[model samples]
Target: MTARANTVAVGYLHALLDYARARGLALDALRAALPFDPSDRDARVPEALGAALFDRAAALLEDDALGLHVGEQVRPGHYGALGFVAMNCERLGEALDALRRYQALVIDLGGVGLKRDEQTCTLSWNPGTDGPYRQLAEFNLAGLVTFARWMAGAWAKPLRIDVMYAAPADTREHTRILGCPLRFAQACYRVVLPIDALDAPLIQPDPAMRELMQRLADQQLRALPRGDDWLTRLRAQIARRLRQPPVELDAVAAALALSSRSLQRRLQAEGLRFSALVEQVRRELAERHLADASLDLADIALLLGYSEQSAFQRAFKRWTGQTPAQWRAAHTEPRN
Candidate 1:
């Protein structure tokens, strides 16, 4: 399918809006600002619009730590399919695995990353390389910590928390809410927790319920729109259908529910061409495929929609001034 706009599910905002309402903020003003009905839990808005709303809400409430408070208010229901799956997992580690796999069901602002060592494991939210996401970052980290506490216990605190943004004028709330050592202006947003904590059993663990939720989550993930903008959506569609025959303009247009002419027009509007876009997608996918050592050159060529290894080699050289094998050799990690 075609890539869709970078959007955030409205359900994620429910906690923030409800938190505002609880604090005596009027609903009418915010409701009027939204393009869709606030009660339409399945609705989504552009990522930029979501950020604007957060800024506006902070102004209206006159609270700088609004994002943290809103995150504190998040319930399992706010996370949609991901929440249910996490709730039913056998242990905290399984629940975290569910979160890592299904985070996009809640927000596309960034990805969830987990790193482990013998003593502790670090769970981090890596926001997109570009964007004004300070508040959203705060919300994400806060929500993750809060949800873990809810599932486990109050004592299930992180060893420390790392935030990407600089320290605000007052961090008392940050300390109070996070309940851990805090570091600001860090390179990434993350929380370090004892590995044993992840082994703790969840309060609610249902294997049957987890299975059902996983199926539903998979379907939702497949149906969700692909990316942050139209071009991204288009590129994603191309990548998905690359291995299938005829990854042409018309085929891609039809996949996105657009006509060939309309798709051409949209690309032109962005000062891009359909052929150029396809080539770009190929270049990107080629690099990614090459990173995996198991895939042979012939397999990589076919995956990129090339009919012959020689032709794929020529394109790779033209794109990167190096043969595919050479590129792979340079990038691949050395064997231990």
Candidate 2:
């Protein structure tokens, strides 16, 4: 799974899967669609597919600030070796610096950049190439800030959260997740911290663990494949537009602010067809939606933008060789 540079660590996927299951989601449907063993903690997956799965989880949960929730939930173990490396650093600054270098273990998309002023030391994320990743960017930075607080103590919340996009209609969730006021339509996505927090000692400093985690992280990095930023962005867009049916090539292009012809040319360069990507998104979401027993097949069909239940059934059959009910019955876990 970690063969391609385009892949993401399966730990991230597993976390989302766990989150969904805790919320009473249908785990069987997710497995039937993605077909991965939950026990494979070290597995890697294509970043696009992973992003699509994450997006699908968000849609099903109906939480727009789901990234914030995910970020705030980050514990040292969730990041695997990288988390181990970060948490073991002696100082918060060293932890942040280590995170900047080893982040590829958790995510391959972005890097951390630092800027210091008289009062605040800004930590900004240089996001991988742009698509609709505002939520993800926020999630990553918020998690980093949370880790920093863990090292520096819980009172050390960020002073500011500079988000690039327009302010979401609801700021309450952001306030709760970030524990700070947000600055919308900013130059980019970055968080501000009072400079003194950097020197705070970690609660559990371990130089020996840091060395071990660093070596393990390097080995994991070597095992991952090369990536395509554009392709990941395209797939993420496809996931988002699933709720808005008739997910056509042109519509996807328009959403990304490109012409249809240009979109095709780019996808062709990646050896992808837009139609194929649409099917991939729908198939993934169909499995996700079907996981919620309260959500019948008819409701799922509409969510996937199908005009009718019959059309969705035909497509699901063609894609999986079984009806949604059959797939769910086969994959769903037995009740206790």
Candidate 3:
């Protein structure tokens, strides 16, 4: 993992540890089992190691939906200076704009983009050089979606979340975690919600806080470090795995040099299950296949871990609420 990836992973782990402590989990025991010093603010661990830790935590807790809980734990206040910006922004759009403007002050692996349609607003990511893990990516996206929804509900109307990701194997679990429509793939990774959501005023609307946060964010942006290529590595790993069928969790874990159980547990702690991550990978592959005119549906299905086309069809419907063919038709427009 690159420095950026390390920072993101560390921040996520920190959040998880905080949650564990609050939940009465044996933090010391879990910390001791981890590879890096949890207390060391500058401690840098391999991205793979960070991922392994996430997996181990999830499995150890025996909570397949741990990611959802983790998402819920992220509050605007948790982001420190960034939190201040979010809290003080006049509306959801302003807050998101602030996030987009200064996210690099917090994480380096990616940047976020806000895309709006007549009925929906989509927050998408442009992965930085150090590519991020699908789980981490999902966790980050889900956390933002959950936070936005909570904020919106507190202020005004609630927005429904729509997640577009690289599909995962455990479609059921992914649906359960998101508690909304989860599209495997069509184009980019995004969280879609109604445009009306932007109108919701933040609960903590203070112009002074917003100004203070803006100043703090400006300072942090100037001092942030830039290194590591985790996002690139993650993209390569996904592409490679998709090209090769039946990519097992254990194989991925072994490549990272950790026990399968440990890997699963750590991912759980980060708010991801291995199965969900795998499905995300598959969803991306499916989208790629669907976009290629030459690749038949059956062939794409086999490449994406489905034993048969029928199974793939069922999964596709569950993922997008539309058949593969239907999704392709809707998304095959020329971009300007």
lDDT against the true structure, each candidate: 0.77, 0.70, 0.60
What TM-score against the true fold does each predicted structure earn? 0.65, 0.60, 0.57
- Candidate 3: which stretches are off by over 4 Å? 1-6, 9-12, 40-49, 128-134, 154-177, 185-187, 228-336
lDDT of 3 by residue, 1-336 (tens): 222344543554576677666777776557644767677643445555655555556666766445556666786654657767877876787777677656655454354555556787666654422333555555565576667666665432224343334565566755554556665543345565677767777767776667677778768765666554332333345557764666777777676666788766545433344555556557656865787767889899878767789999998886555799886765454335
Q: Which scores greater on TM-score, model 1 or model 3?
A: 1
Q: In candidate 3, what residue range of length 10 has the lowest lDDT sum? A: 155-164
Locate the minimum summed-lDDT window of 10 residues in model 2: 125-134
- In model 1, the worst 10-residue window by lDDT is 125-134
Model 3 lDDT, full chain set? 0.60
Error of 2 at 219 (Å): 2.6
lDDT of 2 by residue, 178-256 (tens): 8888888765567777877677788898776776787798787667654444554666788787777666788778877
Q: What TM-score does model 3 achieve against the real structure?
A: 0.57
- Cα lDDT tens digits for candidate 1, 1-336: 332345788998787788878988877767645667788888877776776677778888898988888888789999999999999976787778678667878887444556656899776653443554666667777898899889987536899998777889999988988899999877667788898887788899877687688779989987877634555578789899888757789989998888999987666433355676667678768977897888999999999988999999999986555899997876565456
- Per-candidate Cα RMSD to the true structure, in Å, reads 12.2, 21.7, 15.6
Candidate rank order under TM-score: 1, 2, 3
Ranking by lDDT: 1, 2, 3
Better of 1 and 3 by lDDT: 1
